[model samples]
Each structure stands twice: as structure tokens, then as C-alpha cells.
Target: IIIGEKRLRQQSKDPRTPPSHQPEADITPSPSPRPRPPDNLEEGEVEEVCEISTPPSEVLVVEGQADEPFSTDHAQRLIGQIMVWNGQIDRMRDQIDSMRKRLDTMQQEIKNMIDVLGRI
Candidate 1:
């Protein structure tokens, strides 16, 4: 009888308790077909490139205007620019790898010297 009354009291208290504290979801829905900023656009410039206009090298959200008023020369220029940038990135990566190997060798040498000193 006592346990039953306690449970009933608990249930009554639960109803009076306020809902769990949680952040309210923003009432506004996120913008659809939102204009994305250009990746290569210079600072202070407001160039909005549609997802469709994104280059093949980029992870495109949506394919931008390809047919309407498209320039073949501009496309070719972008391709050439990507090629040069990719080449530079590859060279820098190689240089970084080489430096890492040199650093590892130097570290091993230091460890060996420390071990020899400990023995002495």
C-alpha cells in the first residue's frame, strides 16, 4: 500500500515537473538553392559561383551553369591552372616526405648516442 502511494505521488510530481532543458530548434528553415561563394575568388570581392560552375578538381555541391554563355577559353585556362597547382602540390609533398625521412634518421642517431652515454 505504501509503495503504491509513493509511486502515485512520484507520477503526480512528474506531471508538474517542467520539460527537460534543451535548445529550441531555430524556427526558420535553412535556405534552399542558396548561393555558394567562389573558392578562388579574391578577398573583398562578392563573386557568387553556382555549384555547377565548380571545376572538376573541386568537390562540387551542384553543377553550375555550363550551357548558358559559357566560355571555352576560360574553361581551358582553369584546366591549365589546376594542372600547375597540382604539380606544385606534388613537388611540395615530395619535399616534405624527404625532410621527414632525414628527421627520422637524425632522431635514430640521437637515440643511439643516448644509449651509448647511458652504458658509459
Candidate 2:
């Protein structure tokens, strides 16, 4: 919840500014290249890539999940679980949309307040 609140604070800092008004640099993602070692490194020393481009090349997991022998009961349970997860995802999406609308309304109100103040 703390992390989420921090993200919300950062997002609302400039809620009055629409995405289109934001600079291209701020909207675009920055490239992440592996960092290079300094030239002052010792002659025999070697520097590894500071960035992890990919996870371990391969992961061998024995019996990652023991699959139960095919059974109608298992299939039904799996389907029910999937349905539950889908419903949860849909609810979260709806909540996010609702929050975005509220944010937009607040931004509009702020803009109106500024306009009214300007007229004074």
C-alpha cells in the first residue's frame, strides 16, 4: 500500500497536464545498456556487464508441477480457478478506469478554478 501510494502521489503531481502536453522525452522510455567499466581498471582485472539483459540462459526444474492424472474433477477445478482470476482481473481494470475518470474530473476542476481566479 505504501508503494502504491507513492506511485499515486507521483502520478498526481502534474495531473493537470495531459499526456499530449508532456515532452516526447518524458513519454518515451530510455534505453538501458550494460554499464562499462572505467578505463582506470587494473591490467589483469575484468569487469562483467552491470546490466542483466536476460535471465539465466536455461533453468532446469525437475517436477516443476506434478500433473495429476486426467480427471474431470481436476479439470473443473482448474476452469473455476481461471474464471475466478478473470473476474478479479476485470474488477481491477474497472477500478483503474474509475480512478482515471476521477483524476480527469479533478484536473478539469482545477483548470476551472484557475480560470475563475484569473478573472478576478
> Please, what are the lDDT tens digits per residue for candidate 2 over residues 1-120?
011111111222354653232222212222454355678989788665333232332222223344233468977999999999999999999999999999999999999999999999
Tell me the lDDT of model 1 at 1: 6
Task: Give every collision pair in model 2.
Answer: none
- Candidate 1 Cα outliers beyond 4 Å, as residue runs: 1-68
Tell me the tens digit of each residue's lDDT in model 1 across 1-120: 011111111111344554332323223323355545668878887653323222333221223434233368888999999999999999999999999999999999999999999999
The estimated TM-scores of all candidates read 0.43, 0.43
Best by TM-score: 1
Worst 10 residues of 2 by lDDT: 1-10
Model 1: lDDT equals 0.55
62 in model 1: Cα distance from truth in Å? Answer: 10
Cα deviation at 44, candidate 2, in Å, is 57
